[model samples]
Target: MVSTAAFLRRAFACAAFALVSAAHADLKVGIDLSSTGPAAVIGITSKNAIQMWPATIAGQKAQYIVLDDGTDPGKAVANIRKLIDEDHVDVIVGPNITPAALAALDPVAASQTPMITLIGSASVVEPQEGKRVWAFKMAQTDGAMADVMTRYMANHGVKTVAFIGFADSYGDSWLNEFKRFAELRHIRLVATERFNRNDASVTGQVLKLIAAKPDAVLVAGAGTPAALPQRTLVERGFKGPIYQTHGIATPEFIRLGGKEVEGTLFPTQPVVVARTLPADHPAKKAALAFVTAYEDKYGPGSVTQFAGDAAGVYPRLEDAVARALKKAQPGTVQFRVALREELEHAHELVVPNGVVNTSAKDHVGLDQRASVMGAIRGGKFVFISE
Candidate 1:
């Protein structure tokens, strides 16, 4: 039989171990994406990247709970609620569609959870006031991409351009940003039109655009749906240069557009053309690492800009979690707040797509270094210029 003093010492040691274990509880990440609807191409690639993340982050085991939003805002909101209310996730990631990401804002903000979005639109995190303070974005903003695209057009003598985009928030953001940048570059906007993502024909829009006889045409849509307008333009015999936004950086866009998209140019993250990025480019090594790893698993030329954005989330979390662990244990309100604060303080943190330097004011922190002009050539995305 043990003496009373020895028994007391054993009990104290067990209690100490229990306390330590509680402090290092598993970190939970909830992911919601449009994995089965219109944005499936984008969401699938993002999911692929998320799959490659290690089982642990910053010395704590991580549990990832993924949900499909079906590219619907209602579904996204539902999924976010489930993640927050039921799962009690520490952080939320995704909802790659613009509207979906916007819809998720309330749930995350209400729960004081940090969200790292993979969507291209900046509106989700911009004006960093109100509920947006808890949100961050991994993709480069349309404004930044527009700046590069318009500059390229100016250099190439694209004096006048026609705009055809989605009939949704995604298109609205692109049109606003592109218009602002184009005007600054003296590129006249001759015509503007919009079409639904699921629409089978953009012939009417294409006819209006062709009638304008602009020097070039810019299609501001995402995923495979973006191909409809470009294909219609080519079919209708509008031969001037055609431009697309970074939203079309997936291989599905090229596959769907076929030869019609062969000469299409756009501004995209470095990872879309990782192998072709200049040796000294800041994101080249990181981009290549992602490309190699992703292609190794999913097959060559399978990676997309969405995948690159998702892959970057790991490094951001790793950086933030390391700091947050000191403040509070995972699975608690304090830990989520600490994670959000640390994420805001990111400085020169390099990810697969670009160098991030987020602040309280600017949540989507990317510069010219994050974008490169790319053209579809011989069925592949090739770097045109920085």
Candidate 2:
């Protein structure tokens, strides 16, 4: 039989160890983004925003492991596996390119980890079933942006349009969404073309578009590469109005296209034109706050829509983590599940990008309020009323 004093000591030691374990619980977040290669412009800004996140969340120490996927889908899958299997991260964020995000779905679902992707396509989270149930998106969907763009085109008397987008998932989503919205607005798509993101020349595509003689042209590519088609069109003297998608809102697009993209119109989130937004806009204050914070740290004119999307992740995690803590401690499968469930309950939660109101059926909680018609005038993205 053990002595009474020895039993008391053992009980005290066990209690102390449990207390220490609870105090040291950490919330691990794994981030994989294309910090190099074709989508570097989008990924770099997102990385900047992630760097600004606090070291702690919901009273627990936070650990962030960032990996660069180099804009490659296979690399993204490897990164996701490493983060989940090796690091045992509770949540994963990023792989901002659509193909990479799509490729990462299997690993996240298999491990039951939650992912919040920054890509513009909605296919990663839509249909909200199976593997997609574990995925969520930060950027506004292509369909929503297409809706606003088509509405603007209709109001401006653009009856016919030409389409030239990348030969990738991003372009595929844009093409389908634009088709649906354009059809509803009674706008005819006269010419359709596809080009690789790294292609040096799109002269053949531009020549075809010119031959069609559409009233307007829509370039549905993203980042600096998207400038190729528009610049070629301008060089070829296709004078009709040219529209772009939300994907090309970066400063690099302007620098690359120069005079060619001067009057380009596109649908973008309020953060892209925060200063130009009206006072009554729901996202104005949040957008301005993020712009100021981001530009102050990175320098003037450094903020981008991608950075806004990444920064929004902080508030999203904050809201969900606070509630999730009630269910389980961080670093556990239960904690991850609780966080995912709480994310879907976000209601009117304002962030730098826009207000989010998630639900079981809608992982991306933004609506019309998040989108605005923007035009590049005087080398700046300015808001334009439809």
Per-prediction backbone clash count: 0, 0
Give every collision pair in model 2.
none
Cα lDDT computed for each candidate against the true fold: 0.88, 0.87
Model 1: per-residue Cα lDDT over 182-208, one tens digit each: 999999999999999899888988999
TM-score of 1: 0.93
Q: Which regions in candidate 2 have their CA more than 4 angstroms from the true location?
A: 1-25
> Candidate 1, after superposition: displacement of residue 279 in Å?
0.8
Decoy 2 TM-score against native: 0.93
Work out candidate 2's RMSD over C-alphas.
9.8
Question: What TM-score, computed on C-alpha atoms, does each candidate reach?
Answer: 0.93, 0.93
